[model samples]
Target: MTSLSTVLKESWGLVEDRQDRVAQHFYARLFLSDPQLRDLFPVQMDVQRGRLLGAIVSAVQNFDSPEDIDGYLRSLGRDHRKFHVTPEHYSQVKVALIDAIRAHAGERWNAVYEQAWNDVYDHIAAQMIAGAAEDTEPPYRHAEVIHHERRGADIAVFTCRPLQPLKFRAGQYVSLECHYQPRLWRTYSIANAPREDGTLEFHVRAAGGGWVSSALVRRLKAGDMLRIAAPMGSMTLDPQSRRDIVFVTGGTGLAPVKALLDELTRYNRTRFIHLFRGERQDDDFYDRRHLDEIAESCPWLTIVRAVSDEQGYPGERGAIPDVVSRHGPWRDHDFYVAGSGAMVNATLRRLTEMRIPSTRIKYDAFTDA
Candidate 1:
């Protein structure tokens, strides 16, 4: 008998390249079946469209690793509470997803494949439902932008005060919705540890064709109201581990890493922390002064800044992975990495080559999609 993973992979391969078409078909069928569900998503559906495909692909790729993928799916499910998703919504999604895949697979689609998908999706939905039911926190919270500062041409630093205390670890991220963008939501890491005043900080860099990111960077300002969902992520520091730490980050990925470092400063006495921040150019290093101050006070902290694509640079130069590899023999240190998918993957690859155990490396790929 053919295994479910083999059948799912075979069927998915047929339609993976046509993801956009499949997504369009799925959403059309979904809304047609239940128009009320349309209001759950943003008016601009470009980014939202691809998310469905991405989720399915992730599940398919990790089908064999039930233990590992279950945690991620549950996390995804818990996070979906922000969208007001309920058990009924899962049924709708399952039907729409199966329909989309079947349509895209065409001649290759079979009852066997359909059943396999049903079983897998049912499991996914159940895990998600269980995750949602287990959480007692509110789906989302209202916040007021207390401060906003433009860092560069396309980046901004902002702070928001939640109407209620928004509890979260230093390295977690929360989905945010702005008044200007309505239902459109974007995920941003909190840039500080939990504070007495319940204020949260964020660093945003506008990307081309990014609706929410562009709005946050270019239009958001003080007094603006925003909605923030509960935090989600596991790249936080391990309190039990006494291992020294190395944080590798680039761009606005510095947010969560900075937060982790801030928390570390409060009680960290023995762990020597090395922070390697990379930017395309020197001017792009927006939070230099703040990081420098943190390093000054925290004698255990060392900050290294590297620049790529610039000439006559006074400091470290080259890609982040290359510069980071030079400072190691970091096999003994726990690694926390964040940045673009490319940067994260490259760093992971380099660390693996250095014989760093996979168990000691934690990374979060910062994507607004």
Candidate 2:
């Protein structure tokens, strides 16, 4: 078997020559050969194709050290598991990829190139299979949308069903695909616990000019079909731990934190939970009543609502981290922060400055862009 490093080094020139063509052909062959897989991809093949090729190029170019290369491969394995991509699908991809490379490389390509790619495919497929087995709750699209509600300017809540029963750790997100208009895809964290009932829910906030989000908020209605990728992300509650947990969220970031809170109660681990949520105003908050109810029922749970626009309500004001630092004990508890990239970064920076270890901080930064 050829070593991945050796193969990659030898095929550098060929990969460069055929990268774009290979990506185009890969999608063409995938859709042509397997229509079902086609539905799993974005409607705009050109955009997704560029992204796929760019990812591959970046991986290869960044293969400067063994550790970096191994980490990249591992991440690919993990992502493949999220999509439930099988070894057979990888095999199909390999066949099409090789053909694409050969077609683009022309006479310069030889038996060595074929051997190199074969080794690469085998390595990636083996890792993917192993990873899929290790993931106890692999991500998958649950079901189509049955109902939806527009609660705020850009916020919409959706009720859906999964194709299979989804058993997810709280705070995880599912990727959604919209068929109409811009026809792009994005991921939103689950806002509800894994109920005995067959329904799942998501709260989405439309960022202006956001392709899928704008469509879902303004145009999508009941009974419309949409595609959901499997649940993915590492944000969740730790059941085995006995320490108090603090959940801090901003804007639509409350979705995953809400799911985590629900799961904690469901498991009956009544650890102290301090939820500090920051939004523009009272009306900007989604599902505030439900959160209040959780706070009321669970003596260990405390809900703190913070508004940046301090007009009518006199509560904790300013940024979430500032509010948390002033009101809460920063040294003694586990923390989970979720929200936009700016919020996540701000919180992380403040926590670090407060001498909080990196291990205690877990966050789901909404990076849909």
- Candidate 1, residues 1-369, lDDT tens digits: the string is 877788888888889889889899999989999999999988878768887667776786568867777887787788899888989988998898889989988897889888988988888889989989898988899999999999999999999999988889999999999977888888899999998989999999998878889999999999999999989999898989999999999999999998998899889999999999988899999989989998999999999999998998999999999999999679799999999888999999999899999999999887766
Model 1 spans > 4 angstroms off? 1-3
Clashes of 1: 0
Write candidate 2's Cα lDDT for 270-357 as tens digits: 4788899988787788888888888788888988888888677777777888888887666878899999999999999999988888
- TM-score for each candidate, following the candidate numbering: 0.97, 0.72
- Against the reference, the lDDT scores of all candidates come to 0.90, 0.74
Rate residue 78 of model 2 by lDDT.
60
Q: Cα lDDT of model 1 overall?
A: 0.90
